[model samples]
Target chain A: MNGFGYLRPDSVHEAAEAYAAHPGARFLAGGTNLVDLLKLGVERPSTLIDIGRLPLDSVQELSDGGLRVGATVRNSDLAADPRVRDRYPALSQALLAGASAQLRNAATTGGNLLQRTRCPYFQDLDKPCNKREPGSGCGARDGVHRDHAVLGHSPQCIATHPSDMAVALAALDAQVELYSTAGTRRLPVADFYRLPGEHPERDTWIRPGELITGVRLPAATAGAPSAYRKARDRASYAFALASVAVVLRIQDGVVDQVGIAFGGLAHRPWRARHTELALLGAPATPAAFEGAVALELAHAEPLRDNAYKVPLARNLALDVLNRLAPAPAPA
Target chain B: MTSAPQPGHHSEVTLRVNGKPHTLRVDHRRVLLDLLREELDLTGSKKGCDHGQCGACTVLVDGRRLNSCLLLAVALDGSEITTVEGLGGDGDEPHPLQRAFLDRDAFQCGYCTPGQLCSALGMLAEAAAGHPSHVTGPTAPSGRPVPLDRSEIRERMSGNLCRCGAYPRIVEAIEDVIP
Candidate 1:
């Protein structure tokens, strides 16, 4: 690991000030993904503002019948929380499906959302990855493209977003509360991750000094249907090949509202607006899901290696929707 | 920005391991694995895969199991740690999982044994706390507690890799704690 100045700030304001002063500084929380990336030379911040000391680890109830999860809350803690377990099992299930017990114990919520992709080309410093270096060629485009992105990918980059929690948050319409030296701000979770269009170097829309304070869930959509299904090579501790998070409100045996996001297949958590439109007011059946997937995958440009993800995603969508059909009626 | 490799300054960190406090000055870059083995001479926490892949360095950090190699010594300040050396209560009585491993002969190379024992203890607590396993249903039946089965045990114990094909014995040792 490169030797960098490490400052453990006591408060969020101090940490934000530290980041503003040092343009090349990155906040360290749990340091599971960030440390691994730094060791691989994918990210080399001159200074590390350790924010783990900040008293920001809690799961408090919002007045709007939602949750306010502190960014520093450990993944294990948030997932194992009783309220999160029963009320919002999508988030808990997503967390449980990620990394291992040991890693989840050390991984923080803020850090998990900020984790970079696991593409082989991105991790290998020798390879030319546009996400690592803008204007540089994307080696994953031609070589080792199995885990590369198929949707929302540009010629510059085609890497998948690898966070399991972010997808669930997107489905839940969670809003990210950000604090900077100037003031505080909020961004919808859908707006947090930026699609790799022309500039793949910019993976997120977060500003230089902006600190992720908390991810707040909006008012719960009553009778909401939510499910997270991930397909992978292994049963545990492996990155996903393709996954889908579906939040549907099925009323009168039809899809009244649907929120869909795809992981391991896009630059960001690929929010399927097209699929959502197709499924709205449509019957919640296998045939309806197949058509919605078809519309979304229309723009998907799968490379030579990852054509399998197209069908993998379709089947995953169908399976999750089928399981979600029997949920809303009882509620 | 290129970060130059600068030598870290040593700080005095006091850690309570197995109910005993040990005070020592360790460099920021000194990994916890080396600190346990070299400084405190607690070699029970083995170092198999130093990159957190193998759970050989599984030690309790603030009463939770974590890979020791990935953690730095500076990170463990004010934390209560428990290693294989302290798993047995006060060193007089061996932990139930420890005795079970011995009775079952759950090791061959004896390298992955420490991590296995520590992780088993941690896994048991997690199960008892009703922490849902990835392999189990999200809504695992409410009232009657579930027993840890083969697939459940294998999925929970996947972090600790055994190279000598000793998983059978390891599973046997863990299954005794079902009651």
Candidate 2:
């Protein structure tokens, strides 16, 4: 609610230019997350660039048998889209498991991707958080670290990316299409989010004045069974304690292809590449799934309090993969 | 140098409330709830939690329900809105859900009644459109009575907080409106 300049750009290019022209200018999408953060004094952009009027709300079919979801596509509309749900059930499940109805109705696809961490220390200005204020000191390293990170930890920050949709996108190998005054480029979902290694302030790889235009997901086979399961403290409207998004293409009693991603366990969506490597030729049983999970959790470095997240994530990933086993052929 | 002008006293915002438009300037910091009650004199919408957590300020924006308290008056410049007062039968008659609430004595303190009514109306539409609540699954398409069951109702209506503990009667009123 702090006083700031407001500018409504008619186009994405114009929006990008407006951002570069002004320091601390933020592209306002649905305002579900940004506005609340602003109210909490977590963000104090000198200028507010309103991108609501921009023509980025469409969901189009890419020529390469993929989908280009505009940055402004609401979470609710994205989940309700028949094409997304039919092709990528993981995306649908992840979207449906996000905030409440009113929030999903207002949260934009691009906004959801770039949302700041939900770490309690980061949200509280009184606390010293490296993510919120670099070089200030990270209180979470020795404080209440229940929802802290389990992977991709630096000596500086230990915060988890609180996005459910991004987890599925990471496993699907989605690409983020962005626009800037310079030009346009596509960034893989894996590379989009940055770790807190040295400078935790830089959350994403978005350049100055660069606006996320849309996201493109390469279409998979018709029957590739994909799902996202999140284990939270409660049933609904809660951040995940641990979650997994798995897409498996099993054929002839062998795994043809697999994509595994973990959320609530890392600074970004933790793509379980090692787990995939361990499970490629392995049998499709709970034991094999269990064996593959070790490779994924082997690199996990738990904090003083969140050590349980390692086992929780491993079991959750195994459970998700176990559910993907194909049915036996009729005798 | 002159002092900075105080916000929320401007007379420039043109708001379209429940199909009717009004040209009024309000305090920049004054919430939409205050504007509806103090400025424009439309008081059906109540304010429970000034934050977005409560549904006491629930209102319809082009048929979609939102917490009006969280929305800025200036932000709603040209959107069509619907409050509890604007909903009913053919001119002056109350809507069926409104009648149901009255018949069942759905409210006690009645502070959060306005929000509960509007939320129920929107929840009904969601049910008709096959929108699944938390209790629903992706395996089935939306639309099968939505069950209108107790748990579904509770999940769908969690945004609205009722401190009066009038939940049982409220559920009965909502169940009475199932088509």
Candidate 3:
């Protein structure tokens, strides 16, 4: 790994100043992703601002009944938090479903959301990845594209986001709290990430010196059953081949409210807004679920090696909705 | 604490490992796993993948299991770290988990034993503290002890891979030690 300077700022304002002072400095939270990227030579920051010690590790209940999770809160603690487990079960489940216990223990919430794609081409410095070096070209687009994106992808890059937690946050309508020298601002999770259009280097809307402070989750959907289902190469310790996060409310065999998001299928967490629109007030049946998913995926343009994802996502969506549906009354 | 190091300079890092404090100068890029193995000569924590993918470098940092390879030595200043060397008694008395591994013959080549033992110890503590795994059903409340059944053990230990296929014995060894 390349040698770099290190700074441990105690407060957010100090961190912002440190970033502004150092041109090529990167915020180090948990160091699960940043350190790995440094070793791979994908990232070459001149300095590392260690934000792990900041007093941003709390998981507090917001005044409006929502939950505010600090940036440095480890994934393990966040998953095991009582408020998170009881209110947003899907978020907890999603966090648990990701990486191993050891990784989760060290990975922070903000770092998890800002994690880079795990595309083999992107990680291989020898290959031409537009995300790594703009205008170079994309190897995954023509090479092993099995794990690439099926939606929100362009000819320049087809790499999919590898975060299971972001998918759940997208489904939960979570908002991010960002801070920098300019001041503080908030953005919905869905709008924070962007598609890889012509410039895949910019994974998020965050500017150069911006740092994520925390995330705010709206109140739980009362009486709604939510679930996160991941289909991976292995049962554990593997990224999802396809995953679904759903919060469904059914009343009198009709879908009253629904929240849907897909992972491993797009450049960003694929918020199934179109599918949710089709499912709302629709009959709670496998046929209806299938139609809604199909409508949402109608714009999907799967590559050569990832066509299987289309059916896998559809089947997973059906299974999730089926499990959320109310059981039939006894005859 | 010393001021932050300048670019391309080494920093003085103080790490408390297994009840001993050792201060050393290391580059900012030095990982905790390498520092323990090279600088301190505490080679108990093996480096398998040199990344977080493999659990060979698993160690307890502040009572929680973390991949030491993914942690920078400078980042762990003043943190208490426990490795496989700390699992036994002061003398030759091995920890109960270590003894159970011996009885169950839980290893073949033994390259991954240190990580397996540390991970198991951490897993047991997490279960005792009512932390739930993915296999635990959705409705299971937080802070409620999750049952350490066969599947639960397997799911929890999935991060540590044994190329020799000593998984059954490893699971048995862990099961025997769980109280």
In model 1, the runs with Cα more than 4 Å from the true position are A327-331, B1-10, B141-146
Ranking by TM-score: 3, 1, 2
Which residue pairs does candidate 1 place in steric collision?
A: none
The positional error of residue A313 in candidate 1, measured at the CA in angstroms, is 0.4
Give lDDT tens digits, candidate 2, residues A1-331: 5565667778887888899898988888777667667667788777778787589898999889999999999887787777887788889889878776666766789999998888888888999988888888888889988998999988899988999999999999899998988899999998899988998988889887888999999977766789898888866677888899999887776777889999999889999999899888777777878888898799988888888888888878877787878765778
- State the displacement of the C-alpha of residue A211, model 3, in Å, after optimal TM-score superposition: 0.6
Fnat for the candidates in order = 0.33, 0.04, 0.69
- Model 2 TM: 0.91
Residue A190, model 2: lDDT of 80
For residues B50-123, could you state the per-residue lDDT of candidate 2 as single tens digits?
Answer: 65667898887777777777665655656777888888733888888889999999988898998998888888
Best first by lDDT, ranked: 3, 1, 2
Q: What is the DockQ for all candidates, taken in turn? A: 0.41, 0.28, 0.53
| Native-to-model Cα distance after best TM-score fit, residue A162 in candidate 2, in Å | 1.4
Compose the digit string of candidate 1's lDDT tens values, residues A139-231.
988888888788878888888899988988888888898999889989988889998888878878888898999999876687885878999
Instruction: Give me the candidate number with maximum TM-score.
Output: 3
TM of each candidate vs. truth: 0.93, 0.91, 0.97
Encode model 3's per-residue lDDT on A1-331: one tens digit a residue: 5568899998999999999999899999999998999889999888899999999999998888899999999998999998888888889999999999999999999999999999988899999999999998999887999988998899999999999999999998999999998989999998899999998999999988999999999988787878899999999999999999998889888999899999999989999999999999998888899999999889889999999999999899889889989885667
Pairs that collide, model 3: none
True-structure Cα RMSD, model 2: 3.0
| lDDT over C-alpha atoms for residue A17 of model 1 | 86
- Candidate 3 lDDT over residue span B1-179, tens digit each: 13354545678888889988889888898899998998889899999998798798999999999999999998889999999999894778999999999999999999999999999999999998888889987677679888799999998888888888999999999999889
Clashes of 2: 4
